[model samples]
Target: MTEKQREEAEWESINVLLTTHGLKPLCLVKRTDLKDLIIFDKQSSQRMRQNLTTLVEETSRQQSMIQELIETNQQLKKELQLEKCRVVDQEQRANDLEQILESVKSKVSELEDESLNRVCQQQNKIKDLQKEHTALQAKCQYYKKKRLEQEETIAFLQKDIYRLKKEEEERIVTQNRVFSYLCKRVPHTVLDRQLLCLIDYYESKIRKLHKQRYD
Candidate 1:
């Protein structure tokens, strides 16, 4: 809203023209020789008035259009700022996802290493168990050999016992036969003491013979 001011000379000239012919001057014509060319004719005055009015209307319209353009530009600036904030948020989310992915990969590597270690330990334990099993088998075989030896000894002792029993029975039968022969064949005129002494001597000789046979 800037106000336009005219000089005193130009104001006086416009006043003079209006009083002389009843015509309002819009502008003084720009000519080298004519510094104050005022339009006082009725037709020219009316035409100038119409042109000035049209110019005023066109200026008002242009001012309104300029104000609208200024408002739209401000709104565009606000939208651009919001878009920038959104882009920043999205970038932060992407960074977080990348960190999570790296952490998962690290944990997976640790788990894999643990699994391999466990597998190695299990293999060693299995090897130790196999060695223990082999040792147990050998010990079992040794015990079996000792058991067989004991069995053989027991059989030998049983055979020796049977032989001694048979020999004892044969000696008893021979003693009975000798005693019956002595009772039947002894002389009736021999003295009882002499006969008893002869029986004792024969028993001693039989014992000697039996001992020699054993030797």
Candidate 2:
């Protein structure tokens, strides 16, 4: 057997012997030694001391394990507190984002309303412009019709004026021919004088008619 196993076997044997003798195990102290244990039953006391040493080593190991567990628990608690703080920060950020989104939505709604109103106003303006354009088109058509009528009247008047000018020219030509025939046919002095007087009167009348026609 191993040394530690042999020591445990010896301690077990000593524990049995002490129990059979109705002896209770003694409390161990830090200063206990084999020399001090020599006052007791030798073999049993040595085994008891060895067992107490093993027990103290085991208790130290247990205390070390308990300390490790306490440190681990504290670390876990610290981490949990940090995680809780992060959660609270995230919640606050989420609430802030929600409020910002709500404000953005409100602003967007107002913008949409303004845009709708602008669109309506623009549409109304377009309709008014269309109405004005239509009125202008009517006025333009009326003016075109009046201009056409004036052109037609001017054309008719021009044709009438041309016909009257032609007639006046023909009458002037016939009167000139008649005056030539009268001058050639009439040769008596007194009769010629009377004819010249009649011719002069007729020329004055023609001149007045020409003046009236030109004016």
Q: Single out the weakest 10-residue window by summed lDDT for candidate 1.
A: 1-10
**1-215: candidate 1 lDDT, tens digit per residue:** 11122343565675576556544544434344543343345655675677567557767888888888888888888888888888898899889989999999999999999999999999999999999999989998988898898888888888888877775665545444555576664344546446555656676688789999999
Query: Whole-model Cα lDDT per candidate?
Result: 0.70, 0.76
Q: At residue 179, give the lDDT of candidate 2.
A: 62
The per-prediction CA RMSD against the true structure, in angstroms, equals 11.3, 11.3
User: Model 2: which residue pairs collide?
Assistant: none
Tell me the deviation in Å of residue 185 in model 1.
16
lDDT score of residue 90 within candidate 1? 86
Among all candidates shown, the one with the greatest lDDT = 2
